[model samples]
Target: MSERGRGDRRGGMSRGGRGGAVRGNRGGMGGRGGRGGGGDRRKGREGNNNRQAKKKGGSKVIIEAHRHRGVFIARGKEDMLVTLNMVVGNTVYGEKKVVVEGSSPEEKKEYRQWNPFRSKLAACILRGIRDIYMGPGSKVLYLGAASGTTVSHVSDIVGPTGAVYAVEMAHRPGRELIEVAKIRTNIVPIIEDARYPAKYRMIVPMVDVLFADVAQRAQAQIFSINASNFLKNDGHFVISIKASCIDSTVAPSTVFSKVRDELIENQFKPIEQISLEPYERDHAVVTGVYRPSKKEKAPE
Candidate 1:
């Protein structure tokens, strides 16, 4: 597995600025206080108005449900992928937060901005991948959950009813993942190698989806073993393949094709293959069902 790093702090699409699509007017008050303290009082009133305006500016952005369940699109100056924040007023990985006021107090929802540059899953969604398999209440087994950056968002998507079993072998990132899990109870951080599922087999149960992002030469093999261990019959699997990680000597297309064939050989029916372009180079996301259940024939 390759080391994961926070690539960029920018949380949304690059339309005209880096501070996201939403912006507010920052009114400046400059001048010495008057003899009666009128200037100071006036400046104070103006500052309060500016603060109120700033708060109002954020509300202009609209939240709409995306084609995929549990995923949403924040529409404003530019479109951004977002997920409802499970832990309100708390942030994971320092991503931007959007607060949307609902009709009722209990209806108020907070969404976390998902950056494609920082997360491969975000990139896959932005790239128009058909189906992710896991949604609300869908249990997931995530391999190579480095620092739980993407896992946290997956946690948000799954909400409280669902669970995400995140496995990270590296001690440093595994620690960070544990911290994320502490905040979001839905995530179960497992510090173990993904190659051997037997080690953590007791902790993880049959999951609706198995997602693998271990950028290793034997990633396909790793995915296969885990799928066999935890994935349910007719369950789906999503794997992110790094071309260079497999064979740097060959072209990326060749590597992708070979990996696809390898997955097919392991009984994975490839549904859609999406290229993570602009966000990540020489990388692709392959998703499909594992051992799809055979449909019964109609009466002849």
Candidate 2:
């Protein structure tokens, strides 16, 4: 992959210089001021609707760049992770989010808040993952991209230069993934089981990173298979493992240890690991490299 397709410098996507800083409406007109003087119920209702539309659905909302590249925290009344909406005014699922257009047609830009509870990758970001190795122009292979909720965010992160090969086993979510891919040219929706990487080898390419959030018991094995096939040598990987999926009877700590060992045995050199606690129960995110050359030792 080209260098531009693999590296997106952190803090590179901030819009502050471009006058896209996070905007807030703390001085919004009070509801009491919304009281219509006539006291007519019909007028009152209309006034209320007009005021509500201005407050919630207004075009004054601000979309600011977050600390992480390609990620945004929006401000109006509450804070939310916003993306440049891939599909204008359309939501893939019933996710809690809003889309706002700029003041003029020349400055039209949309943003969507990312939810941590519904997505493991979002949880990882909220949990303070240093580097997911994803950025503008970085190609990614996403396993278990169900319904394209998180994949949408990944698509935003990669921007238009890169691509995401999203693999889903079920036909139901695959349809939605296709719809998301339709809007975002960077996404390549693959309707196939991730367990067998060879099945979709023709469609996938050597990616900068491989991310897997599968719930299968043999998730580590699945990650290894995909890494060997599409992941570039020494490429990074992030996998979300659900303890209950592997063994409900075992403790989460034990489950994580076993999974880590399995990854090591498969030639993966783990770099960082974090628990997706509070946001997710009995879950963890592991970041690592697929393979590495042996380090040389100095002569004694």
Candidate 3:
């Protein structure tokens, strides 16, 4: 399969720099002033006016269900891809939060903005990939879950009924992932090398979906081995490949073609291949089913 044509970078969603940098709010008025002073009163009035103007200028946001289940779009000042927050009042990687008021106080719902620049999965979605193979109540096995950035979003998509087994080899990011898991009970953080799935076999079961974002040179092999151990037959697999990491000498298209062949040889039926351009250069996301079940013919 060929990668999708590269499109212009989406401008509406917040762009968190590479490595999931925090995108803090900018252009806010700041100053210190004495209480009950005329300046303070004037500033208060101006603040009130600004809030009123903002409210008047179409600041009302409406949440609409996205094509993919468990994913949503917040439309207002800017359209942003969002997932319902599993843990209320917590920010995983400093993403923008959108709160929607319900009929009652307890009914209020919050969503976390998903940045494509910070996540390959998000990039894939924005690039109009046909299927994610994941939704609410899907059991996911996530490899290379660094600091639980995308893992947190996956947890949100899976909701409470589902689970995410996050594996990270490095201790530094593993620690952060552990902290993220502590808050979201659905996530199980396993700090171990993904190359050796047997080491953590006891903690992980055969999952419905396997996602790998490990940019290692042997990433295809790693995905194949892990899929063999933890992925159920006919289960879906989504893997992000960094062409440079695999081989900088060859063209990215060549690298993707080679990886697609490797996956095919390893019992993966590739469904779609999409380029993660604008958000990530020279990167591609490949998704397909593992050991797909054969269809039975109709009675003749």
Highest lDDT model number? 3
lDDT of 2 by residue, 259-286 (tens): 9999999999888889997879899999
Give candidate 2's error at residue 194 in angstroms.
1.2
Model 1 has an lDDT value of 0.82
Model 3 bad stretches (over 4 Å) = 1-49, 53-58
How does residue 12 of candidate 1 score in lDDT?
A: 27
User: Model 1, range 1-300, lDDT digits (tens) per residue?
Assistant: 111111122332332223444444444442354332435656756756765655553324667888888888777556677888899878876676667666787876787888888888889998999999878999999999999989999999998999999999999999999998889999999999999999999999999999989989999999999998999989999999999999999999999999999989988999999999988999999999999988999999
- Model 3 TM-score, 2 decimals: 0.84
Clashing pairs in 3: none
- Native-structure RMSD, model 3: 7.3
In TM-score terms, candidate 2 sits at 0.78
| Local distance difference test values of all predictions, in order | 0.82, 0.75, 0.83
When summed lDDT is taken over every stretch of 10 residues in candidate 1, the lowest stretch is 1-10
Which of 2 and 3 is ahead in lDDT? 3
Per-residue C-alpha lDDT of model 3 across residues 1-300, encoded as one tens digit per residue: 111111011222344445442322222232344342434555666655544544443245677888888888876555678888888788888787776666787976788889888889999998899999999999999999999999999999999999999999999999999999999999999999999999999999999999999999999999999999999999999999999999999999999999999999999999999999888999999999999999999899
lDDT score at residue 104, model 2, on the 0-100 scale: 75
Off by over 4 Å in 2: 1-62, 96-104, 293-300
